[model samples]
Target: MTVTYLLVDGENIDATLGTSILGRRPTPEERPRWDRLLSFARDTWGQPANGLFFLNASNGLPMTFVQALRALGYTPVPLSGTEDQKVVDIAIQRTLDAIADRDDDVMLVSHDGDFLESVEGLLDGERRVGLIAFDEFRNTGFTPLKHRGLQFFDLEHDTHAFNSTLPRLRIIPIEDFDPAQFL
Candidate 1:
């Protein structure tokens, strides 16, 4: 079977879908959904595959968040750049590169449309590229790729019922960390 690689945009995922879980400091509750997402990926794609989360490297992230992701088998990679950082784009490119030499399936979980080109390249290269994002959020924007014959994977909102589920970031204390200045 071809190896599967998951490229996660942690901030994008949290900011876009976290609203569904309304509450203060909902990290604990989000954990179960997070695990479920991973489990879904594993069951759908298989385990022992690469899972990397792209995070803002310049501003630095709380060790707690990093550790939590690590515990879930996600490799947190820091991208170089501050508020002006293009790390997300770079990170996506890196994912494409990693799968260039092998026959692998690429899964990107984010609502960011900036990755359209990179995703197109993956398709052109004959690699299986799947986009995983919130269904509601995805519909809010227009995706030309969708019409251009791109395949996407929508995560079910019923993450709570998944047997292998992880917590979902329903609410985060952005005021404490000051996400605007931090990321």
Candidate 2:
């Protein structure tokens, strides 16, 4: 199985997972286990992975987060502006469009509702799209989609294990990673 692509919503998923499980900012003590998570991604669909991390370019992202993902073998794609502008969502859609014609599977990492249409389109095009998120509540209108093989990652269940295995993870504080306001 050629695991073609994996899209990650860096801020949304990480922030949610960190707060709910870590109870604070993520520590460097969890790097290796996190690496194992990436390893899970690699092994789940088989090798030769194309990982893309989606972040908001306008609201800005932390360089450390970008670098961390890059180190994990993911290409970071930052979309400019807000969700209302839908730039991040649109970028992911375009990427999906590029591969929709091919027989490839995509792993989407987000709880954002905006992806419903895009995910539907991918599924309609015969692409196996897997939704990855840490959200435990399943009745958020996306349950139907989840039933269609939407993968859920319980940070609560996995974080401690992740932390125990992976320590000394490189970190960039949010305050330091914020972008400068030119306006």
Candidate 3:
């Protein structure tokens, strides 16, 4: 049977949402619905999806969020390290390396470019690889992966993982602009 490893980098997603997209902390209505993301992953490949949420718990474990992740069928991978180390990224990168040896597919839910190398390694005809993020905020470095067959799905649009539409700034097509409506 086919299976997909849905790896989530919560920090990267949250940073992009608050800093690049929203310009402020996301309200409850704007927060992503984790369950919806998991469902989307399962539906994408029509197979069972194992969601793994990575967090930098060097400060302390957020029990509430960890519990929520468990309730939603995601394994919470909290990591710790030295002050300068990026624990979550390290763990996710290592996990990706390990997944490269397996036949199961991968869906990474982060806009960070740090995983580009690992992602590229997984495109060797052994399994399907996918990236999930907001189109406007995703790193341009990942663009080339599309030509190599790495599918991309928008977290909000494709996954519908939020209750309300998020306010994001994206370039609009000149043809899409209606001056009369604004006037």
Candidate with the greatest TM-score versus the true structure: 3
User: Order of all candidates by TM-score, from best down to worst?
Assistant: 3, 1, 2
**Per-model lDDT:** 0.64, 0.62, 0.90
Model 2 accuracy (lDDT, Cα): 0.62
TM-score of 3: 0.92
Give me the displacement of residue 122 in model 2, in angstroms: 2.3
Say which prediction, candidate 2 or candidate 3, comes out ahead on TM-score: 3
What are the RMSD figures for all models against the true structure?
A: 10.1, 11.6, 2.5
Model 1 per-residue lDDT tens digits across residues 1-183: 776687887777666545653333335444335555566566765544567877876766777978987898888887767676678777777777767667777777777777766676666536566777755566334366666545666654433322333334433345545566437
Q: How far is 163's C-alpha from truth in model 3 (Å)?
A: 0.6
Model 2 misplacement above 4 A: 18-34, 59-61, 82-86, 124-126, 137-139, 146-161, 164-183
lDDT of 1: 0.64
Write one digit per residue (lDDT tens) for candidate 3, span 1-183.
Answer: 769999999999888888887899877567799999999999988999999999999999999999999999999999999999999999999999999878899999999899999999999976889999998878899999898889988888789998886776655569767678459
> How well does candidate 2 score on lDDT at residue 73?
72
Count clashing residue pairs in model 3. 0
* Pairs with steric clashes in candidate 3: none
TM-score attained by model 1: 0.69
Candidate 1, residue 69: Cα displacement in angstroms equals 1.7
